[model samples]
Target: MEPLDKEQQLERLYATPPVYEWELIVNPMHFRTKFACLLSLTFTFIGVGIFILLPSLKGLMIASSPIIVGSLMYPWSRYLLNADKRHYYAINKYGMYSTSEQIIPEIAYTIVRRSAWVGCAICVFAAIFIGPIAFVGAGGAALMSFTMTNFRSVPHKSQCLFDGYAKLRNYRENEYSLYTEYYHYGFDLMIPESKLMSIIGVIKQYNDTFEEEFVDLYKDSKFQARPIILEIVR
Candidate 1:
């Protein structure tokens, strides 16, 4: 789907947010997630190899690839392909919040961006020395991104429009995610399919109905002078 423009993004804010709470699970077995992890470990291995064979500025980048990839990419991969742990979350006017259905809620955060750089970083480094390897790595990253985007779950608030990016998909049963704000303190709502259409309609109508009222409030706010009267009551 095409990306939401600013107006649509704002309109989405009008929906009462749905909160999804599930036990945190980063299932690394999914093909796309595993592929991302494989790319990460591969670069880490190459970095280690460079550090062992030719330790220098060039070798340092190869070696540091692990940290860069580990910090930046692994977390992202796990989030995109998180496990379906059983939990409960609720949404209200204040914010989307969750409570742990289990004793421990360990998920920390979800990544919104696919860190393709992790896959290609090594390739670029290799280009400085081994051109062919870079091409292979870049190609793999491009391929991985295709799968990654298919299952990607961008983060949304508890009260978000039910259509577009916030819409839940039960077909795969894996394209939803969550982050631990504290132990069971945040929400990752997975709306039911049966109710999805009605909820979307209700929210859209509410937003549309109030569009003029909210936008034109300032236009009708012109002040009128009147005789001043002051009263004091004790």
Candidate 2:
């Protein structure tokens, strides 16, 4: 008789339905944006120093400082707080993908919206503090600040393979809520970090010897569907 394997053991336990089948793809735009935001925020602090501590810019400081700070810091803080949760998957015969940008555009929009309000509020504050010079200085700073803060990812040649607008979906199970992004690649996968059992389950389902339909899913196995799992050492 053949040796009983781990996959065989799992098949006997935790019976899963076909319709709930999922292929997970990890897209790390959030992690990358978090790093970028942190860097941008640091630069914003430097700009603040130049505005406040530098004696030469004292006359223009109030207006410029808020503008510069708002422009840079606002976007940085916004993206940091609201960066999207993106995932990629292929469902049935269709390719579907989603990203945080698609799922929570309001979160991103709110950041910019608040920054715009800050610019306007500073303009009023400047008028109260000084006069025309203050207003001009404050307004100019605010405009620049707004410009820097609200910058977004534009579709251009330089974007990475994972960078682009993708589809978004929301999942609600009992009390848990999850946001997912699906990227439609003709045939590309973004591997995600998940629980060891979850990963094994996907592999077992796909590699099930009882089913030959799994092989038909991908035409090419070379770069297409290479097994990512090995024996779990326990």
Candidate 3:
């Protein structure tokens, strides 16, 4: 059993899953749904700061803040809140994949949707108890949540993976998002900090000895998919 285990581990390490099936574990209830109350408070502070710092742009800031928060924050926040669900995806070396044919997201989406009502109630409560200042702020945040698009990852039956290797992009809440002068077909993803150190190790290995399909893009000169740190800008 030990020998077999070692053999399997080696196989997984070397074998590329070009046309294999992998289940992406996704939480239906994502953390962003929980940001409603917090964002409401933040807007209040920003509003106060703007009013204090530059009174002239109060109207402009007030009008634009919601639009900004709604457009960027709202959609990103949608990714934050989700129910517990698993999405099945198939990826190929050529950058193609397929998802379940279901047109709608998992039932967990409804649960997260309803949770927004609770989020609304929290905002209303915060507005009342926290004072009129907070009330205004909460209203703005709630409005953004409402008017802003709640983007969801709609499952498709099948699709081609955009051709590109996974590039290293480290996103921290504190840092601004970085730009890439060169663009590739693959999407940029945020990896867990814990896994980051290990990723660097893999890249180093590829530099030392070009192997591992996962590391192929990073070393290849044609695409030059070298790692570039990316952060999500708030």
Candidate 4:
């Protein structure tokens, strides 16, 4: 038989009705406060130092632009990206499929507006020090930064399909999440504690090679580490 193409494979996978399905609403502020504070403080210091060194009205605007934009946009972006959004997942005989709701237009607008402001700040800073010629270099840098941001911001896969046969190991990381790896890819499943075992049972039915073992999720030590044993207790 001829090899199936990407579209065909996806069609075949989706044709199988899901045995189980679930949804999760992620907390926008989950484990992010400390990191956000550190980021904001570092930018604040930079802006302050720039103002002190230049000591002018123009310097004030140039320096404060990023700080102002970052302060407002970071939280707004996070909320827009995650608030009220539901991640959907389904499992069948072939594999598991997952997707999340997103506000594409709002997300794109925020990213573009923030990147433009930061780019303008860079251009102004450069022009003050290096004259008209600096605009060329600064403009190039800004474009490069914008391109890199867009590249990173775009989601590579709208829906992720994980093949059951390809799964290598599964680790339970508390009541809310499960971590799994296969070959070069690793994924986290946001499954409720109550439904976790049932989902595993469905997967095991399709994948005969399924095996449970203890392994360190995080390798904190090179010489010695305690491994967490993962198994289904009847």
Each model's TM-score?
0.28, 0.36, 0.30, 0.63
- RMSD after CA superposition, every candidate: 20.3, 15.4, 14.7, 7.1
Candidate 2 has its poorest 10 consecutive residues by lDDT at 170-179
- Tens digit of lDDT per residue, candidate 4, span 104-184? 456565666566666666666657765565433234444543543442233323333444443434443432232234434
Task: For candidate 2, write residues 1-234 as lDDT tens digits.
Answer: 885464553343223322223333222242454556665566555556545654454455553655355455545554543343333232221112222222246566566667666766666566666566564335555565456456454321111111222222111110111112322322233333344235334433433221111114334444331323221211
Estimate, for each residue in 1-234, the C-alpha lDDT of model 3 and write its tens digit: 454453454344335564434343433333445465466445545656645654554334343343334344443444443223344543334332334322245454464455455455555554555445443434666664453234344554433232122333433321111112232333333333444455345434333222222323234355321222232121
| Model 4 segments more than 4 A misplaced | 1-7, 73-85, 101-184, 219-234
Residue 163, model 4: lDDT of 46
lDDT of each: 0.40, 0.39, 0.40, 0.53
- Flag the better candidate by TM-score, 2 or 3: 2
Residue pair clashes in candidate 2: 63-138, 67-141, 71-145, 71-149, 97-182, 97-183, 98-167, 98-181, 98-182, 99-181
Ranking by TM-score: 4, 2, 3, 1
- The top-ranked prediction according to lDDT is 4
